[model samples]
Target: MGKNQKKKSNKRFWWVLISVIIIVGVGSSLFFFNFFGIGIDALNNSDTAGSVEQKDLSKKEEEKINQVRSTVGESHQDLGDFVASTHEFYNDTTGYGGINNLDWEEQKNKSEQVIMEIEKLTLDVSDESLKQDLQSILNVSQQAIEEEEAEDVRSLHRYFHDLDIALNDYQSYDRIWNVTETLKEVR
Candidate 1:
């Protein structure tokens, strides 16, 4: 071929090559985005499902409150054991205060944990009224604990007393059910 003719042929070859590359790249990207979209959709669905399962939001808020009550039952058992142990130790040692000063410190720490945990009890459910009620319960418990712990005690009796009342409200099936039933009625 003549020099100009040969140069034109090479230029055409390059154009064809570039066009093929562009077509393939665009096609691949479309496929990738389509598949990626499905993956993202699946992930979102599972995340929502997992939240419901983990929080037991599928059941009414009342049921979740009832579960909290059962947990308090175990906590009561533990508290009773702790009180007995402290008493036994105090009796075994002459002039020993009912429970050492350190016990109070530990309980004070526990008070914060309890307050934060109950406060953060996420009601992902959309019932604003139920959420407010749960917050009220937690607030009362937090206030009682704060007041009780501010006092110095020879024993853990007062601390446990406040804690028991806090748990009592949480464990009351009738009370929680009534509130939840009311909420359901209004909704």
Candidate 2:
């Protein structure tokens, strides 16, 4: 090829590369605060009263449940808020191409499943609420494995499955967190 032709081709290649980098950077960075909201807060809260033990079995378990429950709530809030707002941003920025991506529809189904799990996690108006609550939250955690980003679906599924195994280590239907909930109540 001629020298001038080679120079023009190189310029075009660099321009395309720069454009891709700018688009990806802008897309990924805009969601940083939203993505890490609950994660950062719960880490900061780890040293609070909820982490300590209590004298009574019932109270100690209750406190532990409360701690885990609070963390779960924060995570749900962070993800829910971000997802609810994303459609508006996508509508404004993507000019319909983004709407065509079937990934969003799959994500929508996963989020709905989590919402159903959360619905089950609420109080049952009974005195023995902790048992039901723990069971519900365990189900919710399983649902969360399904709710992960599409890019990591299989990996997350396997990871959370392992988490499930670890949680159920005592040969019971209930889990370590079930015992932990006894602490949260006592605290």
Candidate 3:
């Protein structure tokens, strides 16, 4: 009876040891290969699944940030062109036209289109000052557009001056610099 009991205990010990070794080996391999699902399946916990999901979410967010940054960079370049066109309307005199005789509809339409593009971009900035700066730009831009559409020469000229200043500030803004830094990190 004693011998039989000893043999049964030895068998149980070996079985448990082997099971543990197998589990440890598989877990190690899965971790090495980045197959984290094994942890979730074997452990029956949500930690691994949650972490994987978080990583995927972060990747999506990074992609969105990159897209916005690219669009904003392109838009910034176009902004300079818009300013030039506005300047040209005031400076270049054709044989048929002169200063103060300019039709601003074309420029207004272009500005509105660019504004729509900017509105479509997702700006998830956290800084209060940056947010205010962006708001100022939007406000000034809308005011300028309204004045242009109304053909209010006085207000339009004033708003255009304000828009120019806002745009210049945006060109060297901290938020844009921060975005550039973030792009560097993602790369």
Candidate 4:
């Protein structure tokens, strides 16, 4: 190629490269600013925008809610204690110590006591959903108690699984209640 032709071609390549770079840089900056600027604005305006107004609870309603909370909290604690005790009993019977050391009558009595406590809690619970959950747990525990032999360990495991799920639900409810209470205080 001639020297003049080569110089012209190099100039054209440089121009095209610079043009592409400028286009890409502009596109990137536009995207960055548009996306993040809206995000920051939304964060700043969150309290005012699309906020739900929570009305203050009436005296009677407040008392009822507090009573429900107390009952549920107490029941949750009782269930937790029962679970811990049962777990210890399970570990002692099934661990290296072996099932031979298990006291069947003692286990039966404990199961009866838990069933009685759960029945009372179920009656006291005004929330139908919570009442149903307690009833379900109680039914499962009753089934576990009726099993004739410890050889079928699956029943025991099923009872524990249901108990764990109930405990998690209770904990989640407690956390939600706490968060709402905190928000009320903030307002």
Which candidate should be chosen as best, given lDDT against the real structure?
Answer: 4
- Alpha-carbon shift of residue 139 in model 2 (angstroms): 15
lDDT of 4 by residue, 1-187 (tens): 9999999999999999999999999999779756443333334432122223324445554444555545543466655455555545554444332332346676566567767877765554554555555565566557657874544232343343334333322231121111122122222
TM-score of each candidate structure, all chains considered together: 0.25, 0.21, 0.27, 0.35
User: Residue by residue across 83-187, what tens digits does model 2's lDDT show?
Assistant: 234323332322222222325555445545544644553333232333443454445445545554322232222222222322222121122322233223423
Q: Which is better, 1 or 3, measured by TM-score?
A: 3
Best-first order by lDDT: 4, 3, 1, 2
Model 3 gets an lDDT of 0.41
C-alpha lDDT score of every prediction, in listed order: 0.40, 0.39, 0.41, 0.48
Model 4, poorest ten-residue lDDT window?
173-182
lDDT tens readout by residue for model 3, 16-88: 9999999999988878535322332334422122211212225554455446445543445445345335433
Which predicted model would earn the best TM-score? Answer: 4
Colliding residue pairs in candidate 1: none
lDDT of 1 by residue, 1-92 (tens): 89999999999999999999999999997787564433333334312221111222234555544454355434444433433443333233
- Residue 80 of candidate 1: its Cα lDDT? 31
| Prediction RMSDs, each to the true structure | 21.1, 15.5, 23.2, 17.6
Model 4, TM vs. native: 0.35
Q: What does the lDDT come to for candidate 2? A: 0.39
Alpha-carbon deviation at 159 in model 2, angstroms: 6.5
List candidate 1 segments past 4 Å from native: 38-187
